[model samples]
Structure formats: C-alpha cells, structure tokens
Target: MKRLIRRMTHLRHSDDQISARVRAVLVESLYASPRSLIIGALTSSAIAAVVAAASGDEWLIGCAVLIGLVGAVRIVDALRMRGSATVRQQERGYRIGALTYAGLLGVFGLLTLTRTDSGVLDLLSVTTAIGYAAGIAGRNAGRPLIALSQLCFASLPLVFGLLLPLDPLKALLAAVILLFVLAMSDITQQTYAVILRATTASEEMAALAEHHAGMARRDDLTGMANRTAFREHFEERLRNLTASGEHLALLWLDLDRFKEVNDFFGHLAGNALLVAVARRLEQVLGDRGIVARLGGDEFAILCGVADARAAGCIGSAMLEAVRQPVGFNGHDLRTTASIGIAIAPDNGRDADTLLKNADLALYRAKEKGRGRFFFYEPLMDEKIERRRQIALAMDGALERNEFELVYQPIFDLAKGRITSCETLLRWNSPQFGSISPAEFIPIAEDNTLIVMIGDWVLRQACRTAAHWPADVTIAVNLSPVQLRAPDLTHAVLAALSASGLPPERLTLEVTESVLLDDVDRSLAALSALNRIHVCTTLDDFGTGYSSLSYLTQFPFQTLKIDRSFVIDLEHNPASVAIVQTIVDLAAKLGMRTVAEGVETPAQLDQLRRTRCDAVQGFLLARPMSAPEVIGLFAEQAAFRSNPGQPALPGAD
Candidate 1:
C-alpha cells in the first residue's frame, strides 16, 4: 500500500509537469483578442443594472457597484495586454482578473435568484450566468483550468439557487445546466490538445530544416566546413576586410603522396588519417582562423594577417602541425603538406582571382618540392600563359612537321662500340624556336599530348633504326602518362610493324615513378612489352623508393643509373662505390647497366674500373642528327674493317 501511494504521488507530479507545459503553450490564446472580455464586461454591467432597478434592493445595489468595478478592471487589463512584452506576468494578471470577474457574476446570480422573487429579475439572473459559463469554452479554452473554473464559478450558484426551490421544473433546469457545463469541459480539452499538437509539429519542422541547412555546409567525414561554406565564408571575410582596411589571407593546402596512402593502405585508413589531420589543423588554428576541407586531400584556411610574412608564419605552423605522424591502426602514418597563400588586396581583391592565385601558388610549391609554402606572384601568371601557349602549339606541331628525333649513342665500355642509340625529341617551334625537352615535355604530359608525341617518336625511331646495323638497337623513353595509355602495347606493335623493325631491336625505358603509382597496371603494361620480346629498362634507377623491389617485380633488361650519382663519380668515392655496387647487383641479376652523364676521363676511368657495361654522355658523343649518326656509323664500320684505328674521340 505504501509503494502504491508513492507511485501514485510520482505519477501525479509527472502529470502536473505535463499540464504546466500545455498551459504555457496555450496561455497566449486567452489574451489573443479583447472582444470576448469586452462583451463579458458589458453583459455583467447590464445584468447588474437591470436586477438592481427591478428589485430596488440596497444590498443588490451594492452588488451592482461591485460588478461595475470588476467589469471595468478586467476590460482595462485585457486592453493593456495587447503589446505587452512580459507574457508570464501578464498571464498571471489575466488569470486573476478572469477568476475574480467570474466569481462576482456567480455571487450576483445567487443573490438575484434567491432574494428577488420578480420573474423578470430571476430570468435575467439565470440567463446571464449560464451564457457566461458557455462562453468560457471558446474564450479560455487554451487554459483548461481557467475554462473549467469559470464554468463552475459562473453557473454552479445558479444551479444551487434553482435546486433550493425543491420543484420538479426547477430541478430539471438545474440538472440541464450541470450537463451543459460538463459538455463545455470536453470541448475545452479537445481544443487545447489540437493547438498543442499543431504548435509542437511546427516547432519540430523548423528544427529539422535548420539541421539540414547545417549539414549542407559541413563535410560528412571530417565535420569541417565544405567547399561551398568555405567560399561563402571567404567572400564574407573579403567584404569585411574591404570595409576595415585589413588584410585577409587565404591558404590552400594539399597533402603530398596522399594517393599512395590510399593505394598502400585502404581508403578507410586514408579517411581516418584525413580526419586526424583536420583535428590537428583545427587545434593549431584554434579560433585564429577557419579551416575547411575543400575536397579529397585538399583544404583551405581563412585568417586575418598583416602581410605575407605573417601568413608565412601561419603556414609554417600548419606545416609543423601536419608533419607530426598520425597514429592509425597501431602504425604511425606520416605525411606532409604544401601550402599556397594569397593575401587580400595584395594578391587580388576578388574571391575568384584570389582562390585561383592561391591554387597556382600551391602548384608552384609542389613543383619546387613538397613540404613548403609559396606566396602568389604575378610571375606565376606569365608562366601559366607560357604553358598555355606551348599546349596550343603542341596541338598542331606534329602536323606542322616541327618535331624531330635525335639519337645519342650508348658506348660499350668493354666492346668499344656503339651498342644502342637512345631517341630524344626536339621541337623547333616557328613561334618559340628550339624549346628544351625538359621544359616542354612535362607540359605535353599535362595536356595529354605526350601520348601522341610519344607514338610519333616511337615510329620515327623504329624507322631510323631499321636502316642501322641489326646489332644497334633503338631506345625510346616512356613517360608515366604514356605508359598509362590504354593502347600502349598496341602503339608499340604498330610502330614495329610499320617500320619493319624487329621487336628485339627496340627498348622502352621508364623511370621508377611509373612503378610508384598503380604498380599493377604499370607492371602489366611492361609485361606485355616483355612478352613481345621488346626490351624494357628501369631508367633513373636508385632515385626512387624500393628500387630493388621494382627490379624483382619486373624483368628489366637494363638499369640506367640516374645522372645524380654518376655526375660525382670523378671525385666522390661514395659515388664510385654506389656505381660499383649497382653494377655488381645488375650483373648478378643478369641485366646490363648503363651509366649516364659520364663527362670526364676520370669518371670514365672509374666506370671502366667498376666494369660498367655501357656509358652515355658528352665523354663519348653528344646527341646528333640522323645524318650525323649514319656518318658516325660509316666511320665505325671503316674502323672495324681497318682494325688498327683508335675509337672515335668525344664530341663537343
């Protein structure tokens, strides 16, 4: 019994709390309009006046005066509540006035119905009281307590007065009045529930709309602002800075070798790393700036800075923050970022130009090598224009016959003969005159023109080599972009078939970069070439990570040591050792080794001591035209027949 009492008490308290919430929602409706309040006041005044005049009773006259006062007060309260700001205080006042007025009406009804026997007075008293009770259902329905209170206060006394008569007709009228009050109670409750539901649903819809808007501006993975939000924020900052005469900095950042992480590890790990990096950046910036994840492996920051130097300080801090290794899945995942900064009114005032300039600076930073920052400069625009010009010229250069190939002979150190000639492309544009391959080749690759240009080089080299001795093979360099082409093997076969050059007489060289990304695809392409009996060399060996793994991964016929090591072979004992080690490694693997950029006799002597299979540089011969190569071939043939002449000297 005690537990049941305790539970009932708890339930009653819970119900009280719910009733309080419902009352709060509906309370304003009680004061929504003054028409009902005004009507109640006038009706009370008229009834009191009529009852007092008809009966001429002193006590009833006093009651009439009280009714006038209460009616006037309630009317004034309702009128004053029109534009009131304090809802709680005003609602309390309204409730007090309402109950007071209703109670006075009930007192007057009982006085007129009991003391006065005049038929007209009794009829007016009963009708006025019942009419006021019925009006409470509509007027005070928002607060069911007030509605029900008004119903009882205004009509219960009249019911009592009617029952006091002890007549069947009067008893029936009293019971009908009681039934009317009960019906009004039901109507008031139903109305309150409908209003509450409508208000709650409206509030819920508004909240849902706000949440969706927030999601649209945020990145789903990192919870950082997305590109759309970033641009909007950037424009807002720009506008504010324009007014305040302050400088705003926009920094663009890109993760270096991020794709490798996705390739080596899985994308889930990559996403986690990105999230970790974002948290670090936010912590480093604190409230000093806004960092947004623009897109995959890219982010943008907006901050107020004094100048380029200040921006550089922030960029340095970001670099240090990002350099810290992120721990993921029990391993330390390390990465670095390159930053590009563009300051407002200094780089550009508009958002588009500033963002573009910042991205351009980012490209420059990555180009100079990652893990650094670059400020936007006007010169970058000129360089971009130059690239655009080259891209345009390259589109028609092949058709204009502006491109040609030159062959550089690879001298066999032991055989004392030219074993192979590597094909190099040259472009003498009518517009720009003799652009170096280093400058234009990358631009060509960026624009995807390298594939077309590479195909032409392959065919031309094969045709040129078909005229040379069968022992003299033709070598052509393949860019990573060209290797990624879907029909690379077909292009190679077409070149060989069209030129009538044997597949064994052709060698395709690729750098370790090709094997770095998408290694499976790269290996497949090289394997296809290998299957056709065309030779493949891992060019610029020892310059990339896991060089030995690549050697084991593919059957490369030759390994060309990067010029970086061979260039120092004359004086650096380390370089000699490295070259000797590579030669020994290649010999054990049954692959020939070629040393590039061998210029001096000392370098040559060191390589010879190292037993390098082949050497190609200015020490033996520079690259020459096809005619010069044919002439050199004739001279070599004559020397072979003579058998007593020294080998050809190095060319300038």
Candidate 2:
C-alpha cells in the first residue's frame, strides 16, 4: 500500500512539471507571432459565429464573435499601413475605428434587449457604456479630448434610451452600449500612435541641434576649429593641465610672404594655397595636438609636450610640412612658415598672455629672417613693451607734428652742383629720444601706420622742396607697405594736387625688394607714377635678386648704388669692379646712376671716373633741414658771384 501511494505521488509531480513547460512554450510563441494575433482573433470569431448560428440558440455568442472580428480587422489594417500611412490618413483611421466601435456596442446592446429582461439589458448597457467611456478617457495618454469623448459617449447611451424609446428602452440602451465599446478601442489605438509620432519628432530635433552646433565651432575653409572655438577649448584644456601638473605649448605660425602670392596671383589662387596649407598642417600635427585657423594665413597649434625640445620638434615638423610645393591654378608655388612657441608656466598661465607671447616670438623669428621658430624669452617681452610704447608715442607725435624731414643733397658729378635732395625720415620721440628708422619703420609697416606716416612725409617733402629753387628736384623713399595700399594711387594724386609741386620735380625711390615682392603690381604702380612724369629710381640696386631684369622691365629713370659697395670701393678691387659694372649697366639702360655715402675725395674721384651721373654723401653735404640747405646754397651762390671763383670748380 505504501509503494503504490509513493508511485502515485511521483506521477503527480511529473504531470505538474509538464504543464509548466507547456505554458512557457505557449507564451513565447504568442509573443513571437505578430501576424498570428489578427489571424487567430478573426479565425476564432468566425468559428464561434458559425457554431452559434448552426445551433440556433447562441445569439449572444454570435454577437461577441462579430465584435471580435471587427476589432481584429481594424487592428490588422492599422498594422498593415503602419509604415505607409500619411499623417492625414492616420487621423482618418482613428475616426473610422471610433465610429465602428460605437456601432458594434450599439448592436450588442440591441441583442441583449431582445433576449434578456428589460432591467437586465439596461444594466448591461450601462456597464458596457461605462467601460467604453473609461477607454476613451485613457486614450491619447490622458489628453482633454479623450476625457471629453469618453464623457459624451458615456452619457449618450443613458440619455438616448431615456428620451427616444420607439419600441423598448432596453433595445436603445443596448445599441448605445455597443457604440461606446468601439469608441474606446479607437481611442486606445490613436493614443499609442500620437505618442510614437511625438517621440520621433523630439529625436529629430535633438539631432538637428547637434549638427548646427558642430558647424558653429568649425572653420569653413580648413575644417578646423575657428578662433572662437579654439579659445574655449584652449582655456578648458589649460585649466585641466594646470591641475594635473602637465605642460602645454602654444605655437603661433604666420606664412612668410603669403601676401606676395595673393598679389601676384588672384584671390582664387590664394584661397587654394590656403586650403593646401591647411591640409599639410593637419597631416603633420593633427595626431599630436590641436590646430586652428586664427584667420588669414595664420594658424595656431596647441601641443602637450614634456619639454620645450619636444615642442620645438613639432614646430620643425610643421615648417617642413609647409615647405613642400603646393600646385595651384597651374602654378607650383612654395611657401614657408615662421613659428613662435610659448610654453605654459614659462610664458604665461592664460590664453591671452600665451598668445601674445607667441606672437612676439613669431615677430622675432621673422626679424631673424623667416623659416625658423623661436621660444618666448624675457627679453622679447621687454622689446614688445618698448615697441608698444613707441607706437603709442608715434600716434601722439603725428598729431603734435613732431616728425621732421631732413634733405640729403644729391650732387650732379658733371655739373658739380646740387641737382636734387633725398628726403630722409627722422623721428624725435619726446619719451624715448631718437628712434632708429630700422626699428620703427617695420613696426609702422606692420601696424598700417606707415600709410599715415608716408602721407605726412610726402606733403612735408613737397612743401619744403617748394621753398628751394624750382630747378632742384626732391626724392622721397616709399616703403613697400605703403605702395601696396589699395588707395595708394589716389593718395599720391591727392598729395600732388594739395602740395602744388609739379610731378616732374618729385622723384620716388623704391627698393628692388619691392619689385621682387610683386613684379606685376609693382610695374603697374611704377607705370602710373611715370604717367605723371615723376622720376622713378631703383634704390639700393645690385643688393637684391633680379635687379638687372627689373631695370629692363620697368621704366626707371635712375639707379642708386647701395652704400655697401661705395664704402669698400677704395679697399676692395671686386667692390670697385661691381660699382663700375653697375654704372656701365645704368648708362646702357639710359638711366642715370647715383653713388651714395661718398666720404673721401678719392672715393668721389673714383665715382667720377666710373662716369656715375650723381653722388650724395657728407663729402658733398650732410642731410640738413630745408632752411639750412637753402642757406648753404645761398652761400655757394654768393661765392660764385665773386670773380676768380675758379668757376667754382665745375659748379655750373
């Protein structure tokens, strides 16, 4: 008896385990079979309806099956068009489903009224209507429309049955109940659809915002962060590095002679060169640090390095990267960059200070002759401060008319008389005394103050020369920066018109370096000046490349021999040969030659023998104020009037 009992207990346990496994399999199948939902609902409802009709006593079963069939069809249609429904179509579907549900509930209520007692039908109708009302309220995720729809649907069934009972109140109540059920089902589906649409819109908006932000930070030309973004990122990194005891280096790079390229070629070619330069920089430094376009041929890099040497290596790499030729607009162009390196904790702790220090270092590198890098030093900061003070003082000096011009006489060798005077700029700063032209000219050129200063010199020279004999011409040196100004031609015309000096009496001396900078533009400017009949002289000839070529290409009236050759002519045979060759070449070109810095009589004699057209030095007369020059000439004229004069020894 005990064994039989134990066997029965084991069988029972086995049965329970099998039942649990079957239920798990059924649940998994149902979830995975999405199409089976509509299929199963329709099939079940059809089978139930057919069975009820054949039995003839199951009207309630038929009605329930019909309701299930209609619900299944609507859900399946919604699923079928889920990926293809237009917004308007989707809204229309919601309305159709709502009205269908209402019709179905009304039909079910009518069936109940025909079979059950009046009281029973009324109660069933009210209960079904309440369920429909709740479903509508829950639809649209608790939107006010859902609650209003529910309230209207719920009240309709009771009110219709009470007011308009043509045959029986129960029948009307049943119809109203059926309508309420369908409305609730429609509300539920519409609410789910609305939630999905809203979610999609939010996600799309977020993505668009992210895209715009990315564009805002990036430079369009180089695809690198722009100056504004660079500053923000640089500051953040600096703060982090400061806390971590790490060092950072900032390199400010400026392309040497980039403007020459732009002037020679068109701006399109210039833009192409810039793009190619950006690519080279990216290839060289992108892996190690951050690079940014600080605008107009200037690029900045932020590097994390252990020491200054490593930072230097990176800078050297960058220089080499840009040295390669970039082909643009059918021309192979070459360029080089001057870099300034400023180390954190050594140069400064913040972005502005570091950037300023790097820029100063860059200036030093350029002054040392480009294609090199310099680390910021204490002395550099001192020089920068001094320049700033000088620039400020220069600004005030212009307003106070502290700048003055001194005339150095250019004597005609054949006539042995002063034929013209070259105007030399002199700055007597109240704060710092005498500032060298070599020092201040470059500063002025860079800051664009040269334009103002150049204009002042032109007006002053013309005004002062007007006081001298009309036969004596006045020569003014023009800085290359001033020549390249867009309004340069206009400015010259205005100065001539205002000063009342004949263009024929004015001589403009330009360096060969200016021609090399932009041969075409320089020629154009020279041609314009020549059209006005101004004498154009090639200043400091033989010192720059392509001098002889420039002499033939442009319409120059004179060649001023550089003082270097003149100073060593007495000592160096080669120097004398070079001077003689230049003089001969000038004669061949039909341009007069002037020898500057003639000190001794022997030097003057040698220059005369070379057949140089003119000479200027302390040996003849030093640079003097306008009045001093007029006084010297007056004294010489008086000496000539006295007989014996020896004819003033060739002073005609």
Candidate 3:
C-alpha cells in the first residue's frame, strides 16, 4: 500500500504554490517523466536492435529511428520543465510530449495489427503490449489521461490482430486482452479522480493561506500595508542600506484637522477620504518610496534616498498632491499633511527606533505649525516626552477644576476706558506647576480633548463675566477643533443662557487658519454666532495666509494685529507700515483694530496716531484674576463716568 502511495504521489509542493499545472510540472520533473522515459527508451531501442539482428527488417529499423526521435523530443521537453520555463511553456511542452508518446505507441501497435506475419513478430507485439500496460500503470497513474492514452494505443491493436486470425484460441486470447484493457482503463479513471482531488485540495489550501496573508499585511480600509508590513519592510530596507552603504529616509505623516472631516461629514466620508489619500500617496510616491498606513490619519513612507534635501523635496511634492481638493458627492473637501522625517543610520539602525524618531519629528512639524515637514533631531525626543507627560496630566484636570481664566483688559483708546476683557485659559496642575498654553493646548488638540476643554472654557468665561458691569464684554478665542463641532453655535447659546450674559456681551475670536478647512462649515458657524448678535473678531491679523480674503468673507467686527508685527513696531519700518495699513483697512471697512503686545511708549504713540481702535498689552493692564478685574473695574467705574479725568498715558 505504501509503495503504491509513493508511486502515485508527486512532490509535496513548494512555498510559491500558485496553480495545479505548476504543481504537476514540478512533480513530473522530479518523478514521472524521467522514469517513463528510461523504461520506454530501453524497451523500444532493445526491441529494434534485436529485430535488426534477427531479420534485418528495414521497416523495423525506421520505426526504431522514429522512437529515437520521440525519445529525444521527450528529453528536451523534460529539460524545459526542469528549468525556468513559464507556466504556458511548461503546459504546452507537457501536451506535446504526451502526444508524441501516444503517436509513437500507436505506430508500433499498427505495425503489429496490419503488416506483421512472422512468429517472432507476433510474440514481440504481444510482449510489447503487455509491458506497455504494466509500465503505464506504474509510471503514468499520476497523470491519468496520458496513462490511458498510452495504454489504449499500445494494447488495442494487439487485441485486434489476435481476433483477425479467426481461430478459437486466438479469439480467447483477444477476449483476455480486451478484459485487461478494460481493467487498465478503470485504473486510469480511478487514478484521475485521486489526482484531481489532491490538486484541488492543494489549490484550496493555498488560496486560504493567501487570504490570511493578505489580511495580516494589508489594511482593510485603505488597502495599503498595515503596521506589521510597515515594520518588516522598513527593517529590510535598513539592512539593505547597511550593505549598499546608502541612506533611507523614513517619513511619518499625519493629516491636519482630519477629525473635523469625520465630525462634520460622517465616518463614511472620512473613510472615503482615507482611501483617496492612500491612492494619492501611491500616485505621488510611485516607485520612489513605500507608503503604509500606520493607523488613522497617519501614514509612514520609506524612501531610498538618505539625503535630507532630496527627502524634503519629495515631502514637498507629497504635500502639494494632498493639498488638491477632493470632490466627494459634489462637496469639495481639502486637506493638508504634516510630515516628519528620519534618515537611516542617522536616525536609527532598526525599524522601531526609526519609526519612533520619525514620530518625534512629526510633532515638531505640527508644533512649528501644521502643513510642513521637519527632520528628526535629538532635542525633539525630549519635547515629545514632555508633551506625553502633560497629556497624561490633562486627562482629568477639567473635572478637578484645575483650569482658570485670567482676564486681560482690551482698552478703548477713544472712549478712554476699558471696554472688553479677553479670556485666556490657564492650567495650574498639581502634578506640573503652571503648564503653558502653548505646551498643553496642542497636547489636548492631538488627544481630541480640545473641544471638551474649549466648551468648558466658554461656559466658565461667560459665567464669570456675566457678573461684571453690563458694558464690559467678554472675549474668548475658539479653537479650530471647537469651530468644527456641529453644536458650536448651540454651545455658545447655551453658555450665554446658563450665564445670563446677553448675546451681544459675548465675542468669539478665531484665526484665518480655522476657516481654511471646510470654509463653508466655518462660515456657517460664524454666521450662526453673528445672527444672535455675538461679535466676531479675526485674531492674529496679518499672521495667517489669507487675511484680506478672510475679512471679505466673514463678518468680523474687530481685527487684532498679531504680536509679531507689534513687537518691532517702533524699530522696523516694515512693522510700522503693516500696522498702518491694517488700521487704514479696518477704518475703511468699518471694523475696529486692536494692536496687541504693546510694551513701549513709542509703539503705543504710533498705534494711537495710526487711529487704531483699541490696544491690549502689559503696558496697559496685565492678565489678572476675576476678583482683581472686578476691583479694578469698581475703582475705575466712577472715574471713567466722571469724563473729566485724563487717561493714564499708554492705557488709552
């Protein structure tokens, strides 16, 4: 039984198992073809040599030559099978080889059936048929169709010859031969079933394995490689870099303000956006690098170039590609990415280290500002760890009420009194002594805690200011995250109602950066606020990309000149000219202008002469506690209403 199984089976299989034909060729190359060729060549050549010695028959000699030619062809086909022949070539070779064997066996059988008359010839023909049957049963069972072909062509004519003699003994012999042919045919049919079953099983197993492999390596949503694939590929590239003495750059990119897309448009749109982004990365990077999705809104690239400048150029190109508008269901959605890069051997020698360093650089790019790229530096890791610690501390700071707002008065220059106080959020955690807004706010934004914190800030600021004099308004800066919230207008209205602050007494300040993404949504949100008489101010004027355009689109009652322009106001003509131009523009547009960060007397004098509507800085009044602001207002209420007291020098 074991011997039969051994003869029936082929090679188990190789790892690259693709199709059944490939498996058959591999098996025949290793087993069936060579064995059958050896037996057939020895039997035919020896019979031809013997017949030539006994009768010197030219016909038999010619048949011998034909057999030799067939043998040679089979050998060539076998060689092709063993080598690098393509699947099509291998299948074609197998078919031709099988046909050649069938034709040669048919010719030998015909010689016995029609032209042969000698006793030795009769014996030779019978012996050849019997041997052929035995050989095919053993050697060709694995490929049953070819085995049956050879069996029929070799045995059927011998049976025909025996029956034509018209004798009872010969008739009986023919009956026996026919029975043998029936038995061999049955074996071939059964063998075909077994071979087909085995091949189909193998194909099914291979398909299942391939499906699992795809699942493990590919992201189901984006169809790009997943984290496991990224790590393996990145590490392999590192090894190649070591051997080739070349450099590889690893880029970690994150979509800027991507959550807002999900928040506003729903997860389906966000998912479609991710798929589009993956395709865009493939289109932009092409063969220059490998792109993989690290996880939501984050992707990593492995580029062959080690040079920072070349990588930077590639990064810039990718940025340009992503910045194009993606049209979805007639809505044009735009997005940008922040990229961080780390070079191989310079950043790290392994995948984990390289990914880590690249992530560190990514945050730096975000910190400097989003929609840019930064290279990895040692100091970045320290900053990253610091941010991580701050993020950990901020988890419950709101519930604990560790957050407070300090009011910095915005002075009314023409009125000679304080008009509004800008509410600035402050966090003095028990774990970390007073964390800077610059540091903790970004952490909150990254962790998706900004909206909750912003809502809390708005409610608290309004509640605190509602107790102040009705004329003193409260101004609050809204995060882009908060602006993207669907219920932002409702949140503002709820805050005012909860605080009993009049709608007109609350102002919301926003940057042009907030409006850059989903302009329609931001515009709608600003309009909603304005409809309720909530004043809108464009904060950090001249600092964002499109100031003039923003002023035209949004109903901004006030424009605050950025601190950058104010710092060098007296010393730099460019600064003075910018402030003058902004003031002039604001006046013509009927909007108030506030110059922030005023420190020296000359800066204040220049701002007032330029007809700036208001000023807010340390020179006038520092950010103070609510109680301190209440006391200052109480002390100034009588003096302000008197209308006879001169304003403090720069406070105006």
Q: Is candidate 2 or candidate 3 better by lDDT?
A: 3
lDDT of 3 by residue, 1-652 (tens): 2432333343223213446554554345334467566667667656755654455556656776776677677766655554576554654566566556555654665565456567786577567656766577556665554565567666766777677768799789878877786677667657655765676687688778989998899998988899899888877777677556567998899999898888887888888888888899899889987899989999988888847888898889888888887888887777899999998888888888988898889988888878999999998888787887888999999999999889999988887678899999999999989988988887898888999999998999999998898898999999888887988988998999999999999999998777876678889989989999999999998877888998899889999999899999888999889999999999899999998998877888888888898999988889999999998787677776776765743444
Strongest candidate by TM-score: 3
Misplaced by over 4 Å in model 2 are 1-215, 220-223, 240-247, 256-276, 304-336, 345-349, 392-402, 484-494, 546-554, 569-578, 600-611, 643-652
Query: How well is each residue in 328-423 modelled by candidate 1, as lDDT tens digits?
Result: 888677789999999998889999999989988987787676799999998898786677688788888999999999999998987778989999
lDDT of each: 0.84, 0.73, 0.79
What is the descending lDDT order?
A: 1, 3, 2
lDDT of 2 by residue, 1-652 (tens): 2433353355335424433323233222222334543553454344435434543546756666766767676667646653465444543454455455545554554454445455644455545646555644454332323234434544454545544546665456546655654455456445634643554465467668978888888888879888988899889978877655567999999998776577656678778888888888888886777899989999999978888998999999999998888888678777789999999977899999999999889988887878999999979988877877787788768888778889998888877667899999999888899888998887787656787899989888988887778789999999887676656677777877888888899999999988876576688888888987888999999899988789779999999999999999888899899999999988887899999998887788788789999999987788899898899779667755776563223332
TM-score each candidate: 0.64, 0.65, 0.75
- Model 1, global lDDT: 0.84
Best of the candidates, lDDT:
1
In angstroms, the error of model 1 at 304 is 4.1
Which residue pairs clash in candidate 2?
Answer: 101-182, 102-179, 105-178, 105-179, 106-175, 106-178, 106-179, 109-174
Model 2 residue 220 CA deviation (Å) reads 5.3
Residue pairs with clashing backbones, model 3:
none
